[model samples]
Target: MTTVESKTTSAEATKLTVPSRPGFRIGRLSLVRRPFKVLVNLVLLAALLMLVCINIGRGDFPLSIGHVIDVLLGGGTRIERFIVMDLRLPRSPTGVLVGMALGMSGAVTQSISRNSLASPDILGITAGASAAAVALIVLGGGSAFAGVLATLGLPLAALIGGIATAAIIYALAWKRGVQGFRLILVGIAVNAMLTASIGWLLISADINDVSRAQLWLNGSLNGADWGSVWPVMSAVLIVGGLTVVSSFTLGALRLGDDNARSLGVRLQLRQAALLLAAVALAAIATAAAGPVGFVALAAPQIALRLVRTPGPPIIASAILGGLLVVGSDLIARTILPVELPVGIVTSALGGPFLLYLLVRSNRKASA
Candidate 1:
């Protein structure tokens, strides 16, 4: 038998051949291993591009899409360049940036909380920022520094408020390792109290102040120049970078405290870092876009569903959030002869989806 085996040819050797183990792939496609998800992202990107193109040419004095493209390529009339560069491009980027911040923050918060319902608004972050901005606007009327004060103080105040709220909630919920339900309950309570505070501030303010507050609350991108764009862009860049860096820790955290700890992940420190970054992002976005609610709530969940993965899906959420804001703003501007508030359009569009989520979730739980 040994002699016969030794005499075997290369072709006959296959008769007793061991199965070859599959080799590891080394490429981007191999890395993700999820082509449909990539296709979905591509579709979203395409839709967003189309929407931007359509909105660029829409106004009382509408420019052609071709002219808009020409302007983007660095050749167009003075008005065309001004409108594209000065007006539409800035607004578009602002919407996109704010949406990105909101979406990423929302994803982080919901993951950290381990509660699908946890959102920037639900955690009192947006409410805090809005309250601070409204107070500044109401109390500092008629001064040259009024806008400056509101703009500058808004993010800072929001930052403080968000940190305080998170601290309080975390402290309160720290019985046996910050359970998701407990955190969400505390967050909801804090959000309600802060929202009521905002209402009272509005109720006591003068009509003009209230009107200004209302517009801010409605989250307009009407005058989003580069100056206005930078703060938000900076916040998105800094906080976003921080989040991406900590994303692996976040994935670990999703496995629960004990498992994460066993894996050599420092639980409290990583959680604090992620939470702080998330809060900062939410605060900055809120300061920029008022309480642009529901986008934050809806975008991440939608993205997770689309991506068919777990743990925040931050990049996809950001993209979708930006698209949602820009598309909603476009609808707000064009659907009515008079422009609607961007916030109002987002709420209107997002509210229905939110209701669907709630009902579906409820049904699932009950079932």
Candidate 2:
């Protein structure tokens, strides 16, 4: 062969041998595919499904998984349908959706702040919602007129309070620009204040009102019905969708502000947008199922480790979050003679995890 022809053939061979990048593109958006992450998500999803079936089947009238499936598929007796469909079904979905929202929100906040400790519960977003909802519950009392107002206004009040708290935290954190550590510090302070406010409200409220608000503050799905599930589902579909779509910015932000800016990321605008979405997700979840603690804090980190991703993978985090909550709810309902709130189970599990993270961070810093 001629020298030029030999060189061209070798170059073509090299091109053929080199592998392409592992993701597909859709219009302007490029999504990177990770097989391990996909497998993790699928496994998490299957676990969540299994937990849901177990949760549905185990109660005073214990049905088998097959029986639950039969009831779900519209083949069960009326009593079985009523038992599974009417009562037990709502709680699992509500917990799953709430977990998914919290998980995604946690992932966004942690990624943006570049801090493992940054989550809605720690950062006061959930606290703000809790305070607002408690205030409404206390003020409304048991009077017919006030009760109606509180019933109608509780979710709205929580939403507004969460947004307002996030705005305050952002403003306080913004010294020239919002730093991750500063944001976390500000969030912690705000959360403390909100926690105090909720306590004061509970102390000053009527006994009946306090009773109601206290149950909510503990984050129970005791009263969850189909009514509670739809709002959370809607929020997840809308705000959650927006959060997922905009998450590409998180990669650039993780590389530091100068790098992000170099990549044409409007840093302030993007941060604010992401923070807003995260806050909204947490607030809506709180409204639906009170402040289910630590799901947000734990899910993303667990998912990050599981997926072996530099940043938390949103979908994996979400699925694992669902699994965590559903499984916790199952434990809460079945393990004890008296059912406990799902939040109690999560808190019991997450408290140690949080401490472990803190200890790990401390060790790394000392090193």
Candidate 3:
């Protein structure tokens, strides 16, 4: 039989037969088939690239985009090199990496839960990271040891917290077996409790420490350097690799557990792998950028709506999240008279959409 597949569409379309070979298989054929989605993803990348250059050139000591490109390509004046290579280059990529990580995490999370609202931020994973990082910053001897704490201690703390929270939510949601709705409910409760704990920590800290903790809580890439960029890049590569490897299993999972099992998908193993990857990505991204809200919650859903695919489209989601974050950070830094944290801009953008999702979800449940 000839292979036929639905290129991403809101309405069903005739399956088109695409020529495929051994090296470039059906999965690769999907890339060829979904040309429109691919073009949209490319546009998002171009926008992100433009924003990166724009962000690099925007500051008190402004440089040109041409100069930024020259420095990036390894030929510029000493000051230009320092500005583009040493300073600004790291910042935009940091945002992109964090966004990609959150986007991937969100895609896996929503796909695994089979719920559109199921994101790391909404489910307490980011809150758990925030709480742990806050405790370490406010109470772990303050900025005197900030170099050591930020580089060594806090990321580790956040990862542990996220994993612990994920475990707890899974346990609480487990009745006979885990259900998506129960998992989401448990996550919401867990998120609320963690948020309250973050508030308490904020109130109890010294004023200086409060300032330091606030930066993390608000999630800024201001003055971010190579140190921050590498870990997030490493995470996006590793966890992203795992997600790509497990895509078939993930697609099987959307078929429901029994159907998945009949098709030889190791339900528990696949679920655990997907969750571990998602939790790890979200934890590291939070550790890098603080609890940058709404990117995780919105990116995959936006991608899903755009792609109209059966499962969360990870590539589109990552691109959309990166675009959203990079654009938001640009506005935060350059547009306003006072620089706002990138988180504030994202929250402003995401809040109304999130409310709409919640109301729609509630109405659906009631109906």
Tens digit of per-residue lDDT, candidate 3, span 1-367: 2233333541244333434422335754543356666777887788778878888889878988898888888988898888778767888999999999999999998888888889999999999878878888887755553344466576787888899899999889988767788889999999999999989988988899899988878888885788888888998898888897777787888888798899898887788779989999999999888888999889988887887778788887887888778888999998988999899999999999899889989999999
- Candidate achieving the largest TM-score: 2
For each candidate in the order shown, give its overall lDDT on alpha carbons. Answer: 0.80, 0.89, 0.84
Q: What does the lDDT come to for candidate 2? A: 0.89
- Candidate 1: segments with Cα more than 4 A from true spot: 1-35, 141-152
Tell me how far the alpha carbon of residue 322 in candidate 1 is from the true structure, in angstroms, after superposition: 0.3
The runs of at least 3 residues in candidate 3 whose Cα sits more than 4 Å from the true structure, single-residue gaps closed, are 1-33, 141-152, 362-367
Pairs in clash, predicted candidate 1:
none
Deviation of model 2 at 138, angstroms: 0.7
- Best by lDDT, which number? 2
Q: Candidate 2 regions off by >4 Å?
A: 1-20, 27-29, 141-152
Which lDDT tens digits does candidate 1 get at residues 14-78?
75584443334666322324567668888988877777777888886798878887889999989
So what's the TM-score on candidate 3?
0.87
Provide TM-scores for the models. Answer: 0.85, 0.92, 0.87
Decide which is better by lDDT, 1 or 2. 2
